[model samples]
Target: MAAVSPREERKARLAEAVWRIIAERGITAVSVRTVAAEAGMAVGSLRNLFSTQTGLLEFSAELMVERAAARVTAITPSTDAVAYALAAICELMPLTPETRREFEINIALIAETPAHPGLARIRDHAHTQLLDLFTRIAAMLRGETAAPSPASRTNGRRLLALADGLGLHLLHQRASDDIGWAVDIVRDELHRIKSAAIGD
Candidate 1:
């Protein structure tokens, strides 16, 4: 991999500081001063990078999406459609510490969207990407090579809803809790969708 530039490294550090503040103190605690302090940078220096708090928060949200997208994109393509679909879906859930942090940051950013309208665009973009992935998964499960049929599209929406609901629930669960049940729920849903597609 290529080396990270100085500016990119600084931005990444600042975004991580934003994520830590959101996870520990809440989004309301995220200000230029607090983030600068957390990142161990002077206030004036932070200003040089991020002129406003909104810009900082927007970059943080965009970084979160980029990180999640990278993980999903890294999944190895599998010959088993169900296995591939499950792996991709599970990557979105807060099953591990890294993913949990990502989800926390995601939820915080989403809640602040009403006040920071800029974040809504990032959120919408992420949602569209996820929905497209689900549509492709639906097509794969149905053993189709062509564009997704209307039924596959509907099933894709259903799968997305299920994943979203489960992810929210998992966020509230304790770290020690056995999340195997949640994975099973996703597996069951995938099987049901696959069966339905086969029937159609």
Candidate 2:
């Protein structure tokens, strides 16, 4: 197979550097000059890839999504309900260093972009993705014969809300944040929703 082109390689390196900066300091460290310096290149070189500050920030957000998606997708082939549910839930939690960094960076971006429409766009997009993942887990937890009902879907949304809220709290260190806690919280809520949906 052919190797990646120099330009593509440079952009990839630059993006990775941006991740490192955000992960270590914060998004406040992400600028054309800083990112280029981190990438061991010139500011002009970095700008060749990202034309504007908005573009660079948006690409950083995209990297976060890519990382999150890959983590979530790892469990897609599993048929075990518990494992699948755990996998879905784990996607929201920052269990590893990489995930912790990504979530921290993304949250900082969310905070900084309040005045920009990109904030809502990226935040909503991430929420929608979480909802979809939770919906699938909700389905498995509901049982094979259960159908998707209004109450069930709402329950799915609620589960997503709980997970996101817990994840955010965990990230902020304002709550007792642990993987086990996140799992228990999700499972308990999933049970309530499933039982109510099927009238058990």
**Residue by residue across 5-41, what tens digits does model 1's lDDT show?**
9998999999999999999999999999999999999
* lDDT of candidates 1 onward, in order: 0.91, 0.74
Q: Ten residues in a row with the worst lDDT in model 2?
A: 172-181
Which numbered prediction scores highest in lDDT against the true structure?
Answer: 1
Candidate 1: residue 184 lDDT (0-100): 96
Deviation in angstroms for 87 in model 1? 1.0
Prediction 1 global C-alpha lDDT: 0.91
| Clashes in predicted model 1 | 0
